[model samples]
Target: MPSMGCASAIAKIPVSKAGRKNHNRHFGHSEEILTKEEHISAMTIEHEQNTNIDDGEFDQIPQILFEGVSSLKTIGCPGTLIPVTNQTRAVICGADSNNVIAAASLLGRGRCLVFAHSGYPYMFINVDVEDRRFVENCRLWLAKGRNAQFVLIDDTQSLSDVPLDETILVWNGECIKNDTFMQNLHDYLRQGGALVCGATPWGWLQLNSGKILSDLPFFHFCDFIGIKLTENYSNCSNPMPFQLELIQFKNIHHATQKLVADPTDIESLCIVGGACKDLNVDVSGLPIDILKNIAMKAENEVIPSNSCPIQDKCCRQKSNGLCGILCVLTSTKAPGIANFPGDFSHPPVTETHVIFHIESNANEWYCTGYYAVAGIPIQIDVLECMGAMGWSIRIGCHSDHLEVCF
Candidate 1:
């Protein structure tokens, strides 16, 4: 194993491109043949908005982080794992397996960025945290590579001390009711810094709207990010529980793969926020020419509005037994996203219209490009369930009741 001090040598470590031989081919086959105006450059991002770091020093990490025993979640999608680049070295593999729990990606100019799935609630005090590798790895990852000689943060250090650099930062955590944390994140995004929140950046926003209510009507964070909470799918049951079979995970989209170090079998993933798409970060933007020109004209239209008020407010169920603080990716605030209930824990829900379906489903519908939500695994074909067989279909962002029916 390479020592932390030898980051230069570690960056030079030879890694094999064992499994990613067909990325380009796959994208080519699935192309929608977008027009010139549709393809946004990653650098020319249009952000209507926005990190604070303190010490400006790197944290020193102990080798023990790579030595912990583990129990990994092969359950729902843990957010698509980024491709294990030929340059990636397993900083910490999970228990009894080679599944990388923490990894480092050495980019150009001797810059190194590490990703550790440990700062969140689930991984915080679990067995995976035996040596505090998880938390430290995240802090260390943000230290800005090359100059990052220290791998462990001091007792007084936190992400607050990690200086905010202009980069893509994903705040995938449980919940954030703190004002300081919110402000810190706010500052990061305000400077046109790319930030992806697939989890709990909306706790404060939701609280503003009312816990029992998911409207998330107004907030600068929501406006600047171009998104707002609409539902908490914990109550949206799959009605057809017995019929549904094995859990299925949606693969990380091609556009999002760059966000993670080695994007592979990743779950616990939610849709990318609209702000992320506008910023041209990791999210795969909507390809809705078909939906706009053809689908909408057909009467079965999916409009993108800011009014989706759900009456089946079953807030007790929770999504997959986890908090489902679902939010719409758009800034227009009405309520909910296209009448789609917040709860996917029950039946009648086909995970077909996942994050991938956002743009294709008609960006007008506030249904997705959701943030601060949990992943769901289900059976049943989407077309079959929606009863879209030879029927006029229109899906928009505003609604009062059933989203789409036969």
Candidate 2:
């Protein structure tokens, strides 16, 4: 639900042709409840209060939700405000004129050039980001749930004061205006310091479609940090970004009918599609398996696809420790529809969260892994509009790895 927390999470972004324009949409995710009743939707929502709960209420949520993330909640309704930028479609907004959340990014470095969404720091958590203070409960949750640490950098002046080796700067809306500070931060990154621009709702321009296009600025000080914004670019071609198209297998090698040559015949969730449909010979719904990367034999060339393919090519699974598929996404769309040879323990007792970050756009998707005991099926349900900044992921679960390119 975290990934698909937004109503528009699962549905694809509307993509249009030359003259026509497209719009935004929302998708929803549900939980799968296995019970004797046999006839009920999975998403179970038990709202104790109809009224909005304040910071004190956050602790009541289950511990599972904060597995790999920390959260912050604060009291007070000072509200947020910002000053509109001059000669540009930008504005500095927040709880006041000083607490600006958005900025315009000038020509610079790294990924897409545009406004940075200095909004919610982490997409996985739901909270009023205006109250930007790390909650003690959240800190404890991440440490206990994942053995991870969460440190809040309360000051930017400390940037130069501290050493920059493997440092990951999570910039909240606070603008880095001083040229000297920008240069110092940039140099630090060149030396291998990691940088991530947070999200904000400051630069929200009323679009022709009557929709608010919100993005934080990514230029000026952000340039040295490898974040820039492209001018005069305001249109979304693909709306349903997560709709997974099913790419069936076309051809299969006869060897696939038999298990791996090894005596153990280890189970593998092989990445088979295009021409490798033959390898998925488990129509009866038996366990699906593939050779691990280390188990791949020299003869395991490539299985030629039947009906060409999505990107058109032979299909092959790289057995790198593939307890699951490392969906290394290379396209704008993550593989929504995926097939895995189900060989995990019956009735997946553990619910693992797989988070993917889109490089082109700093968007993220939180995929929940569900294994149905009845069919031994593995389903990676991607929640709707969940995204944030960052590359490398901290994965915890019993499945193969998947990478997405968007």
Candidate 3:
């Protein structure tokens, strides 16, 4: 409803406002509220030697929000959506050895920044002087230039009233069951409206029936944005499934360069990766020898087993399938690889259409998709997923959209 900047725009995004009570109530002023000296001492010991925000561009503007912040002390936590640090659009702003403290990116026509922790207004109570300066700086930065108006849609009930302007729309990952709301979003994006749609497919699946990508209420929107949610969840211990690389998509999509950021921060941010049956075709019963041969014989190919380790699971599951080269294997007849060693009638499976794999992580979780349209399409990246907790997408365009993302 008001003009927004990068950092300020995030505050207006429709995230849960729970856990806003003062931390003093949870820790009791006597025990948890450290005196200035005590607080400084505790945080000093925790700084580089113990804190996770030690490395990388922590000095970046986003780190100001964490200044003087030793640890989170809150109650009735509403949880948070873990932003995917490795996607094409996301830029890791700050992180430590364990997690990403902050990330920023451009989507469609707006900017977005995400942090792993929560507790807003209350957390701002008794802020450090320097930290306060950081807030003021962000405000000043916005006033200086990025004073674009933004809209945060808390519910689909108000979709009909979404303002007609250049304002960027931020959708709170609420599932849209109504077609009118879906149509509104579709038209909005088509008309160059910016959007930040949050998603929590895995969390939705916990309370609902069926698979995440298909069952989640915001799925139609997910498809429109070329994002897919997987059942796999990542944490401090697990690693992200896909490598962080800005890709230059073929055809009408433009190429762009990699935004300089810490790969560790990027990897630490993605919390979900899992095999989704809907995103891949069944290549289970296909002969392993031919599949391996196809993977090898294809130009610029590597062994499928080595490249796609998930095939092992598919091998064991029998009913499930392997993707990538196998997807090509089922649909094409490679010169040397298509034929079995001897059986003349058994030309390895072939189809009328070739299934081209656009996403590099297709072997990992099959969570990204591509669709071609008549006009220039909105090229977006699936920044992160928090399973049932929800996910988010940023839409904006800059001059350097040609950055490659393989």
lDDT string, candidate 1, 1-406, tens digits: 1111211111111112212121111111222333323323211122101022211111122232322323223322121122122222233322211122233322221223322221332332232534364334433443432222221222212346654454444434333324445455444433433332333322433333212212221222332222222222111111112110111111123213432332211222222222122222223333333112211221111222225322332321211111111121221222223444444466442334332221122212232223222223222122222211111222232343336521
Angstrom error of the Cα, residue 41, model 1: value is 4.4
**Most accurate candidate by TM-score:** 3
Runs off by more than 4 Å, candidate 2 = 1-116, 122-154, 201-218, 221-406
Worst lDDT 10-window in candidate 2: 242-251
Question: Distance (Å) between predicted and true CA of 243, model 3?
Answer: 11
Residue-wise lDDT of candidate 2 within 32-144, one digit each (tens)? 33331121111111112112332133222223222332322211211221111110111222221122222221111111111234343332233344322332333332222
lDDT of 3 by residue, 1-406 (tens): 1111111111121112212221121111222233323432432332323222222432232333233333322212222232221221222211221122223322232233332222222223335553464334433322223433445565547466866464555555543445556566555544444444444444555555323344344543432232333343224222211112311110001110111122112211111111112223211222446444423443222112323332343232221122232332333333333222333344444322223222221112222222221112232332332222223332222222323311
Q: What's model 3's lDDT at 97? A: 16
Give, for candidate 1, the lowest lDDT window spanning 10 residues: 6-15
The predicted structure with the larger TM-score, 1 or 2, is: 1
Better of 1 and 3 by lDDT: 3
